[model samples]
Target chain A: MKKKNICITLMFSLVLGLCACSQESDSDRPERSETEVRKEEVFGEGEKIKLRGVYLNGDEVQNDIMDNYIKKNWTERFPDVEIEWEGTGDLTNLLKTYSATGDLPDIWYSDAASATAIINAGNQLNLADHITEDHFIDHYVNPEALYYSDGGIYAVSSGIDAFYTPAIYYNKKIFEQYELTEPETYDELIQVCQTLIDDGITPISIVGTTGWSVRNFLFFTILMNDDPKAAQALLSNEIDFSDERVVNALKKIEDMLNMGCFPEGVANIDFSTHMALYAEGKTAMIATMSWGYPELETAQDTGVFMWPSSNPQVKTGQVLQIWGSSLNGWAVNSRSENRDLAVQVAEYCTEQEAFRHAAQGSSLNFKTENPAEVTSELEKERMAIYNNAEQYIKTLHLNAMDSAVAAEFATYTNLLLAGDYTAEQFVKDFNPIWKENTWFEK
Target chain B: MNKFYTKKGKLLFALPGLLLFSVFVIYPMIPQILISFQSHNGAEALGYVGWNNYTNLFQSNVFGKVHRNTYFIVGCSLLIALPVSLLLALLLERASAGVRTVFKFGALFPSVLSVTVIGKMWAGIYDADWGMLNSILRGIGMEQLTRSWLTNADTVVPCIAAAFLWQYIGLNCILFYAGIKAIPEQYYEAAIIDGAGFWRASICITIPLLQDIIKYVVIISTLGSMGMYAHILVMTAGGPGDASRSVLYQMYYKAFSMSQFGEGCAIAVIFIIECIIVSIIINKCIAKEPIQY
Candidate 1:
């Protein structure tokens, strides 16, 4: 019996050993054909199609808009296709896992990196062919952002949330009490923080542990001096991350940390508390993008300022601006049996009718040239910021760099925030990650 | 012929489960090993690049720190949880029926609670300001002892281990309690009659008799420590500059976050080997031969 058990175990082990010599081929990555991508619009007008879509769950508004507002409109246009929406955690990891395992959900929402990885894997449908010049994609408020131009389009998004861009949402009442003017220079911003600090108040409520929150402060420095064009270049080694521009950005954030602008144990405070601290008037300011809206809304006297012109890319009036929004879009899985139908589904989901409804109850600025009609005064203020900017730069750096590098950026930045690394040491420590990166889309 | 037919009938009943075990469990092991050697980019398989993934895994800057963290958590389980669990079981074994019932309820409380709830609860407890832990420390005027428990690199892993131990110690206690109960009461009664004290009876008789369960618990604890990812993920998100990450968290980070699937699988393989080795060592140390009652 013992011998038999040993033999049984040995047999499984041997099988495992043999199977270890793998014959698995590259998944769906055949060599590209010489022809330009087939762009024929394959409209699904018949009963044989089941369109599968992966959507962000818990956004009941977006969900209602998709299920009722958009679905009814879409089916009226193309009657026979059955729409099945799959909801998942709003996680990029979920999409990435599906892509990795050759189980790309038929239609999935994707961020730039997720789409880029899929595109680079040669698994996404070429969207450019089917999307006409007259398509809703052309009307995106920021058409430049509708698709990443890698010689072809691969994804389509409903709209962009321009309001999510980083700004210091300050308590106007507190500023009035303290007689603090909105800062127009990095030094002045520090002075603002210092004046607030001297009055026995936390100068800023920033969530350090939640993510690389310092990146926004640093980006202000970068956008102030340089055009936001080198994100890809820096990753591809065309421009070094150790450049003076990059180092200066790092110093800008480091300076804030050194000045004790953020609260003690800032690294431990989560985003909710960070926002709450500001909402409750415990902090003088919050360095946040529009995602802090609900929190920003509660503080009835909150005023906003762009991170005081760090280096000013343009004259102060025409400073380059960004509205941080979801880098998500709809893409068709190339391996899907219903690839053609999936493309139609992507279009149906992101088209004008859908974009209009999805943008409803959302303060996000869309890429459409035909803007969603703004009813809220707050949205108009957001749009005025969007309108006044010379350049609407997207913060794609997080998605542009290797995920590992981005994570390390956050890690090292947290170290600076946590007092483990001084500004110079932060720069010194950053050089290694910059030197050894493997994931670059360029 | 009838016996053989009956045996075959038993095999037929187990076939579906056996097939599932083969396909879902045994089969995935081979590919998991195979994928470790391949250059999988999470985007697609980039073809085989034998040992390249392992080399990259070794090259990861955080690998050593993560390795140390994993082992430290395992050590915490061994040194702290095991002893506490055994102690609880011993106390429960000797307690009166009502006291035993109360102890059982207390012992199993954390076990039934979700790890997510436990992790989040402990996270709030360990919060630097207004947390139960810091508040108590402040209330006692040991304010210097209070710090951001989850944010400090020195304290993050230990704090997580404490929470993890909170869940696991109870579980192991229940396991040990059951094992102690299974020890025929006659042996304890006879030992007492011979003037053996409780400690002597426990040390000389009860403990030896519980070796079978001890072996099982040790193996489970070792494997549990090896694969512990969720609690740390929920509590820390592997932060304080990734200082609190275990090997499993790193594996997930590498594959999903960095798209380094092959390297992640390599970590998985190395983790599997570590688990197997630990299990073997524990089995050897705990019970070579079963002690018949």
Candidate 2:
């Protein structure tokens, strides 16, 4: 009975105490805290500012080049700043959780997706206010376009980017054996797929079960052959997703599905199986972003073709538009005391000498005209893809559209493959999600 | 005054714990509840919107699917996981002392493994195109039975629940085994002497004595299954579409991925109410039980 009484008393006290803590205080706080007084009185180097930052994890491409640079150079370069780095596989979620608690890091790098998220969370610091030409921000390729809006620059790009929807890597051995030339249009690609299917080999390997293991497959169909201006207009909200052009792009994807271009149960294949199918010479072609180069390189004599567009007028090598996003952009916390220093360090991290190491090591082309030297055949192939293209525009995801539209479209990847949802259904189901989000407004 | 000091001393002893609980658990709820009534993304508090977030959630396309999936997973835990665990516990309890000890130690092994590792192993099993599942199906000449388990919306939740079952079945078995051990052996002996078999004795004596243990298992399993996130996240990542998302996954999607913290907080408040109901049930059930013997 005594033990029960103690437990009841304890529970009641906890409840009461928690209730007391939940109440908002009506009393005003003093403008200056004791810590501020101490900070103001600090001597040399402003009390050694600790710069908290996040970077991509081990599994990502050549992040070691940047981390190595940081390890060897950054510590020596900035003695006054104590760098507390957290290398994470999940920077976006970490930042979201941190933003909820008002615990933003001083610096964080992302594919400039962080800028949208940070600005949405009201934590981004506009770099245009602090960074100057002498500071290396001007050195990045089209630095102005990196910002979502003309108002301010929230992210500084890494000056180099890997092209998405750049090419379809095919097995040169298989192409030679079949007497197949590199495909120049969707029809020709289908002819190749049909030939491979006739030969009892899967034409194009895809990873569907891994939730977007083949993410680039559909969007590139929409954007690849289209003029950069039209894509730009769409991204900048000059047109809606319901536009005929967008629907037509979606229809092209549905057409490809109808052609039986992919393997049986393509939606359920794992990433390893997808890779093995392509690498082990079971599949003739694999369409993917530049990162798949290392895996695709495993095949004997890999041949490359620019992702063929369905538009006949926009013939082979005529459509030059490459999918572009700010590959590695770092944003600083607006409220951090080390905001200025952090911004300075962000620019410094991406300067010519060090960033080239990252770009070359990661097998990416630099934004600078005199970019890193081509070191391998894959590097040479990647360059040809980039050089062949006339212009580059970001996918609809990274630009002015609402993010919900992107997520909605991402879910439809399965439905498109399964033939459950039509292109008309996509436009019908999606327009409301897109329209409800008043982009560039509250 | 001295009596007051004695009570105050006990309260003071609990102050550290109370402060930690208030800061970590209670304080977060204050903001969440306040924000649930407001139109705020994680960025800024946009003015109050009375029940609008809640309305928006129900009105979304995937809400019904998410709820169905969540309830389905919970049902799997209750209908499938509970019985399997109880059977294992009964067998372990009936085992010889040395064998029981060995089984008890072995039961902890799966629970001790990381959820992510376990989820990945099951994902491999469920994978199509030369996966263990399809291979086994083909080996036995049952190749027609295999399908793409994770990608198909119909089977994704079941596959994920299977992963959870693999993890929790052993854990709950150990828990039930401990609870069953506390049942006085003489009651079982007397029941057997009165012409009761193992099944009859268990149904009549052991189960009646296990009301408290059963209550604990049901609540934890139901709530834990309802909050399923990491396993699903690792296995399916909430889709070939959002087919596998539980309510908490939807909350995470809305709050973090979509940056709609207002809706996220509204979902959180809903969960808080759910937790309150769970607590109410627990409190109501805490009345002293009559001895089975």
Candidate 3:
């Protein structure tokens, strides 16, 4: 009994001690409120300012842009400002960790969701007043798109990415041998797939492991079938996922699956595997984003085609979906002593990134023109699709969704692709996720 | 010196470990449990939510699937690992010294490699298009048997278990082998005198003596499976659509990925309770007697 009493006392003391340590105090956090509109402050020429930055440099392309281009130029412009840039694999969790510990960096790279999360935690500095005319001028994507419902700009993009457009990249040699032209409608696509399948070749290959490709396919299909407003309405929770437009789009994907458009066991195919399959000529076509152009450069004679409308009345070019989100870029830490300098660095990086996008000739939403001739044929074809688009629908779902809904969106879409859920089942299962996570003000 | 054995002195010796465990393990659990009953947005707690988080978790469709996946993999690893390890240990016990050395190294090799390397290697083997498994299937005229092993919802959990079992099977064998070596040769000799073959002797003598070690392995294996997250992350990222998510992966996804820290903490709390219950059940069911050998 004495021993039990002693043990209880010890445990109680431990709990009590931990409670004191774990309870967060507002006094511990730096006091800053709302999006502060500040005059442009000049930095002292001789004064040493050191800024720490965190960014996602996991991808080689992003790494090259940051290290060789952005950081390089920033050093040339602000030689006195010492910037320590740390590359992180998982930026969201890292920033969250920093936010909880009250040690957030001067500036960090952010996506829409991460920025929203940090802003809600009151750890991010809003840059609404810090913007210059250069941020809005000659930009295909209006800077207004970056504004939160509260009218605060938290994150700013460098430029628009070719990641906006989803296209079916086909092997030209195979298509030429089969005497098949690019399919202009949904029925025509199915017939082309059938012809490819008949010749003992897989019609398409997609990275099914990550679910993004499959989700893009479904979203683009929806864009082809429904009005741009209806698509936006679905994302804004104005309509249920069980709505006819979404259901019909899911059915079309299911039809593609049933028609053997995708290879057997496609779900196991990852990015590398699908690329290999496409490069090896095992699949006649691959459905992926225009950002995949760099990776597909080595492939033999590839051609690009936009997703055709399933409804014959809806012209293919009448509405085009662009997966552009302004919520991805640099954000300033609210509590930083060097907040102004950090914002300057972030702004510089954003501008340089825009310049790089223009150089690549794939800046879909940015009005920045390519300085040189567009050399890559596939890029040219992607340009043609962009040029032909009558209406450009920004993919608001990517920016508006909370993390939970985004994850479930991928899961349900991947399940649909795997044939584990029928179109009706996908709609029924996904409606709640849509409703639960759709909290953004329209 | 005499004072060192006293209760006060003994407690002094244990203080460091106690403090370390409390700081690293027990201390975090308190806030974690607290967070489980609050609405957390990853970085900060919003307010008290009572049992709402738990109710939400139980009501979630993915929750049941993830739990089922965890149980299936745990069950699979135990069922497949135990007998194979036992058999391997028994076989190695009678083998020549050089062969034993070679086999032992071969068995332990997978365990020595990092989980990332093992995961990637197996992913390559299970690759649908050009993986060795499919290649072999096609080569052997068993082309119909080829599958995207890690992606198929029906086969993903088992495949993950197989990868896990492959890594640990050798370690289990080495453990059993050590236990077999410790057993007195006199028992085997007596069994031989009783007109028993090697298999019969092993069934009677080796099996009974191994209860303690077997219980230890079972506990670790069960707990290990309960906490598995890396292989799933590396191989599938908990997809082919949440079909292969383990309980721990669900916890991670809920907290870090979904930013539902309260739900994540709820899952963690339940996971801790589950591990405790399983340990108790295992303790009661096996190694009833402390072998005096």
Candidate 4:
């Protein structure tokens, strides 16, 4: 009887242990249905391809439009091709790393002028055969903008848009309360700001912490009051920043700050806070880019006008140089296995149809003309600016110079806004870096 | 024959762990040390520049500011957090079992959250216009004091260190609490009988016994405070003119953002050396003989 009881206890314990082992194994196994398995198998059949892209945070070009459209269209168009998209921040560094690793993406998007480093590194694909003159003319409003060294088409340009100046976005409710007319000139704008301040309202909500927004106020004014060619020449090392135009512009911004046009703690205010101040009618005006319209439109009773220039002669003629490029396009990666399929997808996205779709979705696409569905008055004003391309000057940072120089410019601008450096000092700091990194000799 | 077999078995058992430690820790450190001497571009060696990278770093604004900021933050964290944690640990040790468990669990809760989440939450709390702290201050009619906490150079590091204390105090508390709990009941009973009051007993018995654990905690926390990157990155991005930039943060920015791998590696080497020197000095100062109960 004692032996039988011991045997039973041992047998029970063994059975329990086996049950526990089976339970653990079952938990470890990944649960998938037969249909899910089949779907994954079908999806896996295509020749796998990945494309790496670098994009800006506020652009909404890649994530909102291109990625979504490609994912939808690629599988239908090419059943055997699988395209994977890897997006990266900080385009300048990303491209440099890629060049270092020799792991350039199969297809990538980069600014044409700023791509000199990659081109110098011998990593860029020569798309001369892929792009033709007729294609260029049809796609780009100004084909000359796409020109690069070696007289070969390394990349294609997209449709051109007019440059955007730093615009004054005012709260309409505040303006109506003060019975203020839209200021047309720099002096008038200053007077109106003073009036608003006298009426117990903060004159301008400057998000100086953003650095770029503060820079826009400084850069646009300088470009407007100064000779364009001279300013460009100075930036390109043809002249010096110590010139009167640059100095006067810097002085004007400092003068404006001293005049109580900006808030007490303007330098500490971030973009969101500035916008909130405008929305709540605490401030009369805020300076920002054309791209900011989409976000600022969410504010109550918002209105925008071009920033007034100090030079009376050129005030009307001067517009904020569209600080970046219009040549946003897709490229097929040289290392891609499904190069043909990737090119097809790229072409499809850049075509007129995709532009129309993008326009309908409240995004500005390069190829498409004005879409009728863009009912917002602000967008209508933006579309007019886009149509009148000759009225604006294109400041080429994204497409005109090396990206490292632009990043340095951004840093200097930040220092200037932080009151750590003067305009002359800013220029002096960048001159050597530009000489070292760029093709410019001096 | 049995002794020889046991010795062989022990060696065989220890081999795998030793191999892993060498591969993961000892071997990788060799490359890190070597990379410090050569110039690089994020990955590959650009060229050899012995001490040039380090020399340039000394001349740069980022290095001096980061060094000062790291030491300041570590100092603040140690000065404020260590005593608070010890006090909490002592108080909990004197409580009932149920109360002790509750307080211990409460203290450990902050450690459960990731650093990124804590940073973001504090950012909201410290926001100039819409932050909870500012709102409370305004309600109390201290609106003049409402300023951008993270952007102001004078306040940013201390603000970040305060957040660090909140996140880490609980951990230290739990550790010291465990150490205190591990002390035998007889020691405390003898002290009480010898007319030792609570404070006297703690200073004489509890603190001395917990010295090793305290030393370890201080060293680790100091290193952690020096190497703080993610909180600053996610919250302020070492912004408002590099007010909160740490050495590690600067190294990461150079390597990942600017693609100056040579400078970054150089910064890393210097940072490691600083940490080592600091740890050694602390160990020497705080080293104590183990007490026999």
Write one digit per residue (lDDT tens) for candidate 3, span B47-113.
9999999999999888999999999888977898878998999999999999999999999999899
Q: Which candidate leads the pack in DockQ?
A: 3
Candidate fnat values, all: 0.44, 0.30, 0.54, 0.13
Could you give candidate 3's per-residue lDDT for residues A1-442 as a string of tens digits?
5476448646866876666566335578553332122212334455556779988887876887787788778768887777888898888888777775577889888866566667888888778876653344245466566676677877766656434677788999999999999988878888999999899899988877657676654564455544665676765667777778777777877888878888776765677778888888899998877777767767768888888776766787567767756567778886776677677777777767777766765453445554556778778878777887777765545755787887777777777777656889888887877877744743
Q: How well is each residue in A23-100 modelled by candidate 4, as lDDT tens digits? A: 223346444324224335545543343344444333565565555655566567656444556666555567667755
Instruction: At residue B230, give the lDDT of candidate 1.
Output: 93
Candidate 1 on A209-293: residue-level lDDT in tens?
A: 7355665444443445344555434534676656776666667666677788987667766666788889888898887765465
Candidate numbers sorted by lDDT from highest down: 3, 1, 2, 4
- Provide per-model DockQ scores: 0.41, 0.30, 0.53, 0.13
Strongest candidate by lDDT: 3
Model 3: fnat (fraction of native contacts)? 0.54
Candidate 2 per-residue C-alpha lDDT over B1-293 given as tens digits, one digit per residue, 9 for 90 to 100 = 56656756767677678667765676567778889888765656778999999998889768888889888988899899999999999998778999987887788888999988898788889876657988899899998989777777788899999989888898999999989988888887788789999899889887888888888898899889888899987787687668788889888877766767789889889877877887577557753565544
Query: TM-score of the A chain in candidate 4?
Result: 0.75
Candidate 2 lDDT over residue span A1-442, tens digit each = 5466556655765577567544223244333223335345553436765678876674545466455666568767886667788887767667766665667788777544345656765687777757763445556445565554546777665544534444678898898888888887777887888897788777887666532532344454445475445556766777766887777777876776666677655765556667778888878887665566766886557877777767766755555434545424667777666556777677666552345555464333324454456566875776676666666655555555444555555566655655556888877876777777655564
Question: TM-score order of candidates, best first?
Answer: 3, 2, 1, 4
Compare candidates 2 and 3 on lDDT and give the better one.
3
lDDT of each: 0.71, 0.70, 0.78, 0.65
Clashes of each: 15, 3, 2, 2
